[model samples]
Target chain A: MGIFYFVAFLSVFFALMTIFTKNPVHSVLYLVITFFTFTVHYILLNAQFLAVVNFIVYMGAIMVLFLFVLMLLNLNKDTEPMKSTLVKVMGAIAGMCLLATFLGAFRVLEGQNEYVTGNTDVGLVKNLGKVLFDEFLLPFELSSILLLTAMIGAILLAKKETKQG
Target chain B: MEGAFILEKLILVVVVFTVTLVIAMYSTLAERKIAGFMQDRYGPDRAGIFGILQPLCDGGKFFFKEEIIPAGAHKTLFILGPVIAIITACISSAVIPWGQDLVINGRTVSLQVADVNIGVLYVFGVIALGVYGIMLGGWASNNKFSLMGAIRAASQSISYEIGMGLSLIALLMVTETLQLGEIVAQQSGFVNWNIWVQPLGFLIFITCAFAECNRVPFDLPECETELVGGYHTEYSSMKLGLYMFSEYINMFVSSALMATLYFGGYNFPFMYDLGLSQNWITIIGVLVFFLKIFGFIFFFMWIRWTLPRFRYDQLMNLGWKILIPLAIANIVLTGVITLIKDTYFQ
Candidate 1:
């Protein structure tokens, strides 16, 4: 329980830091830490496969790509556009409204929240594989197809604009 | 019992850590000596007989040299780069099965530090994380060449990782387990090695391993004629040593992985027929595993000296077009064959 609270605190803190940091590279680094905390959470849930996949796909590959782009762009304080006073005031107003909505929702659901204490071993690879293949087969296949389509779309967009007659 | 278990694991961790570091240190000397032999010259023989003490001298030099951080560099991440590199390198060894269990005073002690169920994916994750060290060091250097090298490395690693994963999937189908110890156990006699079954997968895997390690033929990230010392351009002293040292460690780890995966780790021919005791068998198995690791290391160096580095376009094409497709085909083939055998032979 203590470990869960500490990790939760770290995730929220790093997520906030990701938004607040001035440097783009540092912001991405903070986001990486946020993802790492999520990985820890998955491990705490006894989902080792999910934790490792999250580590590899998010923190490893996706974050590297993020840093790669940021490095290439070489953005600095000088290049950052100054925001108008009106925009800042508008942003703060929007944030306060969102917070109010969250608080109201939590108030409504206060006593109804329930902890899920089910079969913990369902997260193990063998059990997870069986569940995914037997019960969730359609969704699993659909997700792979979706990913393939997205990949093809990316390749098309990245292709050179060929000269036409 | 719990205290003894903890102590046993602690001691195993220390031994594995020291062995990894020593092998990495010697690999540096071995690489240079191999390079010299290939080029028809004597390599660093003055440090000791056959340059045995050369790595120690190199370590001393790195320590004595002045450390430098560029004025424009990110101070925090500039120091964090090599530290991450060395940490990720050392941690990957935790799941590797060094040998069969050794009984010490009737306490059956496993040679592996941790036999995690997802050992293979853990290795993959660690290898994927390795690029951060290069990318961070390069970007933080605040040099154009460094940034270029870092970008190249990131793309190369990302590209090769897919093929590596696919090839492993084929091997997994054959072995039917994710545990490294189980995989090694499944390959018990001479004829049951994975290489014989999945030759194409092994080829794709070894090629990707070379790319992952940034060895010769896939070493465009550190190409000297370009990039100017690559990602470590602005690094000085032991910081620079850490980067180079981590590469050798990565090499050692990769070689061990290949041996364990395809070449039958810690398993030898006709071992059961020799009538040896369990303790002797375990001892010999450990030695055999190290021998296989050394052989793979020599092969890495041999290729490094023989082959010229690949062009960036060539590297990308081989990774995406050739290796990935081949790996996928190998997976399909393995699946079909397994299905047919199950139906017909049963």
Candidate 2:
């Protein structure tokens, strides 16, 4: 649970860093970190399949393409990056205040009931299949259509634009 | 069964992280050895006794090294990229069942850290997100080569994922289960191996695995001859190490998957008939699972040395035109067979 919190915090911190960076490259890097932490979060949630898929599709595949695109464009370091010492200082103060307030309200942690760790039967692949086919079938089919559209969109965009001139 | 407290899960999570990190350390050693042999040379012989301690030495070197921030880089992403890559690799093994229950002192203990249902789908969803880490690293590096590598990785993964998923659908249709343990259980004998029943699906899976793991022929993004170490070109020290190590770790996971889904994970011939105690059976199951994983890892290394890579379009063609349709046909054929057997034979 502590590790989960750590991962969540890292995810938030990196996500913010990714957004705040003036350098696009830095933004991408932090985003990568964000994805990684999210993978950890997925693992904590007992989503083994989700965690690995995160690596395969997101980190290994998508991120690599993102890097290639960035490199091809050569969007090197930002000329003048955003956020300064003054802004950072103010942010720190705001963050600490938020943290303190949250801590002040965290006494509810003691009153929370525990959750029993149950058998592995529930999370097994069989039950998941049933759920997907029975409950999630429509969404699943819709997503397939969405994916097809995305594939076509990517292909169309990637096609070579002729030099009319 | 334990008390319903975060403590059990918390400890389990920590254990998973630690085990993954440990596996990461050894996988480095395996890569070196395989690479060394491929080149027809002795590999890492100088470290502690047959390079058994090479990873430790490497770890020492990385730790002792200086962390240099590139003068013009986005310092934040530069720091974050490696962390993302490493952590993503480490956390992807959570749902993989190491074996059946470990029965000790008249009690049963499960070998897997967590048994979340929807395990397969969860693996897919998480893998889909992992591409972001590489994307960020390349973008953060602010280098042309790194970004190109990342882009290549992203497109390659996205392109093949459809086929990969489609390939698995047939297996899902057959097993009707998403639990990895159940899959293993279903394939509990040599004859029951899904590889025989779902040969085409297995073929698609193995092919997609090479791409998923970014191995050669499909290793275009990281092809040194072309992209110069691909996305991690600008990365050095532990960050670079994380990118490299994650590849092998992913392969490890994929191996476990290949074994579990097709080869009957942890189910050796006559595994049940051994008449061993449940505890012994559990231990044996874990051993069998690791054996299968190692065999796959070896196959990965072996193939890396044997095959040249496919051009990008060719790779896409294989996944889209070849694999997807083939998987669909296989599913249809299997359905027909099952129907015929159910109706006529019965």
Candidate 3:
């Protein structure tokens, strides 16, 4: 649909702005806008839960953290480390490689894009919950456990540093 | 039919918007009056009877005041901050059901703006996004005090939101749906209210609501003693007014949310026993709902006046250590009890 393309374009544009912005805080703000576009995209796809979760987690919490760190860093042009030509060339090479891989992957899956077809209600909470719990329960629980482990590790590291100091 | 539906929703949205603004406006006066009452002094009674026209005068003062932008401030974001604040504060009212449906000329008009399936989450997301307004405002000012205030706000909101979400999870389990209308509908009679069921969850929720709204006990973001007006240190005139006004608006929305979630919103004790018409019931329900909202708003002011502000560390500890654990335990307890009730009692 036209609305979908417009939102998609907005997402891409904001994502580019996030990367290209000179100021770190402005970059994070652009990233927040990018995340908002993703939320809109989820709504367009009828994934109400996904849309709200993206809005809260990404735009609200994560972006705030990003901006917080940037604000504390107080990065400006005078303080920024200048990149050498070699580093710049390498970065461009890496970026182009990433682009090539993404394009190739899309080309490979060009005809196999059937995951979201013919099911307007698939993204609704009830159906999504049923599928996640009944079919993908293992992966779901495993992901949660991974997050829990990371959280515990971080807390332990923090405690150890406090005791050492 | 389509045109009528659109018109009806437009009217509802306009009504809800106006009511929210009006309540936020009067809440300023009410808060001061209540503070005066607590201090055993006459409040602002000079404007009109009991200072009824005080809010209008205050609005005029704010508009007439000279606006200032700091020389070092980021110009764009400085303006964007309060704009985002007030807009987010107002939009959260869209999903709140003010009363039961009113049937006029055989057309049933729901009292809510949108009966979206994710109504609860929508409110949660909007409220969560409210921190950006403060953060942006504080950071853009390019002042150390403002930046500190912004940082405190960011951490405070993040910490409290977890407890809030966990508390809501317990309520969601009991209601078995995220739809606000459905949740209200389930608690029709007096005894069916969720407050009696999830008392601990309600406590955690109200505490987090206070923190999320940046009220008295959790109001480190704008503590006047050390930071000098905190995040709005460099803000002036109506821009500063927007920040303050948005806080009151947030209070109104959260109070409405509390009434809707726990108090059996718009559902009185025994409506059917009175044999009133549906229209009359709807009308009375709207009045009753507003009464509940006012009660909660008063409670907000009461706590604000009564309690001292929490130390930053104490606030963080209360949020993360106390409230989060209690909320998680409440969810677990709700789950186990529900399972037991279904298997054995039922």
Candidate 1 residue spans exceeding 4 A from truth: A81-116
Model 3 error, position A55 (Å) = 0.7
Arrange candidates, best lDDT first. 3, 1, 2
User: lDDT per residue, candidate 2, A62-111, as tens digits?
Assistant: 66556556656666455445678999999999999999988877765545
| Residue-wise C-alpha lDDT for candidate 1, range B296-316, written one tens digit per residue | 999999999999889999999
lDDT of 2: 0.77
> Quality of candidate 1's docking, in CAPRI categories?
medium
True contacts kept of each: 0.74, 0.62, 0.76
**Model 2 lDDT tens row, B1-346:** 5573355557667876776667668877887798898899988888888899898899888767776666766677777777766666666687787778765566566666667666777676656666666776776687777777777777877877888888898888788777887888788768988988898898888998899778987998887887888888877777777787788678888888888889888888888797898778877888888898889888988888789888888988888889889988988888898889889999
For candidate 1, the share of real interface contacts preserved is: 0.74
* Per-residue lDDT of model 3, residues B120-231, tens digit only: 9999999989999999999999999999999999999999999999999999999999999999999997999999999999999999999999999889999999899999
Error of 3 at A122 (Å): 1.5
Residues forming the 10-long window of minimal summed lDDT in candidate 3 chain B: B264-273
lDDT accuracy of residue B151 in candidate 2: 78
Worst 10 residues of 1 chain A by lDDT: A110-119
Give candidate 1's total backbone clashes. 0
Alpha carbon RMSD to native, model 1 = 2.5
